[model samples]
Target: MVSITFHGGVGEVGGNRILIEDGDVKLWLDFGRSFTAERRFYAGWLQPRGHSQLMDLLEFDLIPPLRGLYAQHHLEGSPIPYEEAHYDAVFISHAHADHVDYVRFLDSSIPIYCGSGTKLFLEASETVGHMDYGEHLYKTFRTGDRIRIGDVEVEPIHVDHSIPAAYGFIIHTSSGSIVYTGDLRRHGPKGEMTEEFLEAAAEAEPEALIIEGTKIDEEEGGLSEGEVYEGVLRVLREAEGKPVFYTQNRRDTDRFRTFYEAAKASGRRLVITTWTAHLLSKLVKDEHLDLPDPMRDEDIAVYFRRKRSGKYREQDYYHWERPYLERKVTAEEIRRRPGEYLVCLELHHFPELIDIKPRGGHYIYSMSEHMEEEALEEELMRNWLSHFSLRLHQLHASGHMGRRELLEAVELINPRRVYPIHTEHPELYRRLLRGRRVENPERGRSYHL
Candidate 1:
């Protein structure tokens, strides 16, 4: 008998952990943290203690208690005894925190598999933020690579998403094929990649389709990445003699490219922080991706803030940040020529506005609108922008498929049974895809195939 367990990503948006067991073969899909659960217990400075680690999280039932699945050190003081890895391997879908953050607690003996670009993302995150994902035997795979683990053979197909190197999986089991869509979007810049994945999934004729429904409730309209680019250009053109500041997910290279192009078209250099410059530098190594080299690109400039001792010193910043110091421009320089540059500033760095002080600039909010839980932060951000007399332009393309597109994709794939995860409105699928077998998975439940 073949069984699938929904450990996470049920009745929520993220924290996907799916266990597929066929006879003696067992493996997990994605081990991610639930944003909803994490916010409920921990907030701001009050976080889970490192020494107590698993104990703190397990106490709140934040992480599922799976024997022999976690590292011995993390399992210490817990009720479950330490044992050898009971699972075969972990197949990561991407490098998003909501999908791969929980991998830090897994046993190092179990191998972790992901795309080659995903490996680079993890390495960069560890180097800059000191966020350790523990020690694990890692294996990298690309599109069309079929990996065999015991009785199951897994094939990863590339999918378009907010982040690069996102993928969907096709698992060939003894019973039938199981398809897992790992945070895909069909309206982004690389929508063709998602089309390729859909074709492959349709050909496989999956018995079970595990898909994400992040925007399943929102029907009809949504902006594409191309539309977002046009919006950025419009904002830049209207800024006139004032500076333009934009904020987006730092990991979103596509959005960076959009702003880069828009800045160039507007005859302005795009100024980014040292951290973003470092990330772009690392990402440029991938020959397939067309990212501008921060070290060589004249259109790109690094923003260096006054560090320790109130001076711009190389030693003040981290080792990774020092590389971009040579191309640094201080706040005074930006203040002198505000209209000549488009600055990329994060919410935390809003204090820098006191120094750069533009008369009346434009602030492009190139990210998702604030969710209900983040209302206070949104209000504070608006207050800051208002204080500076900056015109706020909210232009963003969602990183998920719209309701109609998602329904169409499901119909094309034509899976025998559809289980919607990573969504709050799984029930919408029942109404949307009438006559199809739509299952709303419950957490910690085992469903046999």
Candidate 2:
């Protein structure tokens, strides 16, 4: 018997973790962390109340608490625990933060199986001083590459995602096969390659399809990153006032170009903070995407505004190197007039910047769903829109698959015992794939396979 358990991201889109066991052999699929949901419980010294569900997501294997591999001495607030349990191997699908952030949490000594690009990103994060993660124990493989683990043979099947070089894993045993779609979609520059991978898997015809439903509940299929570009434009075009594009910091260059085009069309200044500037710089370094018309320093504005209740505002324009980006401002910009700006919620200085009611300001919350969107009342999103009096909107697009496509994916893989890991709506997948024996392994519980 082969057993799979959901540690997190079941009935949720992120916190991707799963433990697979056969006989004495036990290993993991993806050990990931979900920041947005964790923030709900532990943000700003406020311990959230009424969390029956939060308790459930926290449970891991008979699951010991995330090990002390991550030294939490300097870590304050909720530093997610590194799951350092003993395992034969840990396989990674991609390098997206949600799927990969927990690397710092895990014991650094374990070997991780991933592609070149994935390892490149994991190393880059460590090299750039983003996190103090230990060196990775990585075995690189191309698509169709297979690695042997005791009695199990794990094959890598490439999948197309916004990010380059992602894949699904095909865990093979003599009795059956388990194909795990490690956080994938049907769209990308590599979509054709992904389709080929799916075709190959169809040929093999796995017994258990341990797939992901990152966006399985949606009516129309999830929007492509390109569609998100169109939606962001629509919000900016239809809005009555200066548009405020609110979103998370994913390394999405396509979305960045979309913002740039919208800013140019609206004839408003394209303003971004220091972080976005750095991200853009990195994009230029790697991929040759089209860039926006450069803005002068005087045209760019930083939102970390200062409170005028007897205070001197210090400017932090450190490492902001844009040859074309001209209009840059610090906390002092608060006294100036209103202009089209790009600012995150944290930078807006609370009600001082937001509560000053304005009719034309369009607020687009491109918030990606986690455990919170369904469980919590939109949390920070609701608070900011209500506080600012700005016309609230959702120009966001998901990074996951929709319901119909997810079913189609299950059909394509043709697994015997289907296990849904990446969806909070695992029951949805359970119902959709009727013929297969679907299992939602109870976290913290042990099963003999």
Candidate 3:
């Protein structure tokens, strides 16, 4: 028998941990953190201890307390004895924090599998101090590759999402084929990839389907990637030669491309942060992404803030960051030629506004609205904009399928049993996918397939 257990992602938006056990062979789909649960106990600087991260999280049941799953270092002083990994492998769907952050606590011996592009994102993020996933024997695969472990043969297929190189999986277990849709969209720039995945999934005739319902509760229609580009282009045109600032997820290459093209069309050079410049440099290796090389692209400029000595010294920045300094654009340059640049700025970098001093510029919020925990941050952001006399433009395109498209995809896949995770309202799937076995999974409960 093939049994699956839900350790997290039960009636929640993230923290997706699904364990599949077939005979003696066990594997994990995704080992993401529970943002909602973490926020409940910790906030701001009051985070888990660095040395005892696993223990602190397990104290509140934030992570699953499974034997032989965590690294020995993380279990240094814990009551649980450390041992070699019992699981065969872990397959990451994408590099999103909600889907891949907690891998740091896992035993190093357990091999982790992900798309080659996802590995690039992870390495870039680690280099920039954004995340620390610790050490692991990583193995990368692409769309057509098939990975075999014990009795399971997993096939990963590319899917259209906000981030590049995202994928869904078709797991061939002893019982039957199980399909897992790791957060996908049908209207993004790579929509055809999603169509291909759906076609293949339907062809497999899987026994179980695990899907994400991030946007299922909302009634609003999702904007296609083209619509987003057009909306942003209109904003750039309306800016009237003022330095328009925008911010989005750092890993979202599609959105970055949208902004890059829009800026080019408007005859403005796109200015990105040093971290973005480094990420782009790494992503250029993937030809399919078609991103601009920040170092060589004349239309792109890297923004560097004065740090440490306050003289923009070479030693102040990391070695990886120093390479992009040749294309650096300081605040004063942007202040003098505001009209010539479309700058990428986030809330943390709002301090630069005092230096740039754009009295009446427009700020484009290219990402989604703030989560409930980010209420105070939003208010602080407004204060900064108000003080700078800047106008806020909330123009964004979601990275998930909307209500109609999500339902349609589910019907088209036509799996025997539909299990919905990664949503607040899992019950909605029962009503939406009528005449289908929609399982509202309970946390920590095992279901036989």
Please give, for residues 291-378, the per-residue lDDT of candidate 2 as tens digits.
4323433333434333343242333223344332244443334224334554444323345454344434666665454523233346
State how far residue 10 of model 3 sits from its true place (Å). 1.1
Candidate 1 off by > 4 Å: 370-376
- After aligning candidate 2 to the native by TM-score, how far in Å is the CA of 282 from where it should be? 3.8
Residue 405 in candidate 1 has what lDDT? 84
Q: After TM-score superposition, what is the CA distance of residue 228 in candidate 1 from its true location, in Å?
A: 0.8
Candidate 2 worst ten-residue window by lDDT: 54-63
lDDT of 2: 0.59
**Cα lDDT listed for each candidate:** 0.89, 0.59, 0.88
What RMSD value applies to candidate 1? 1.4
**Cand. 3 Cα-lDDT:** 0.88
Question: Which has the better lDDT: candidate 1, or candidate 3?
Answer: 1
Question: Which candidate comes out best when scored by lDDT?
Answer: 1
Per-model TM values vs. the true structure: 0.98, 0.71, 0.97
Which pairs in model 1 have colliding backbones? none
TM-score of 1: 0.98
Among residues 3 or more apart in sequence or in different chains, the pairs in candidate 3 whose N, CA or C atoms overlap within 3 Å are: none
lDDT of 3 at 289: 81
**lDDT for each residue of candidate 1 in 154-250, tens digit (9 for 90 to 100):** 9999999988989999999999999999998888889999999999999999999999998899994388888999999998889977989998887
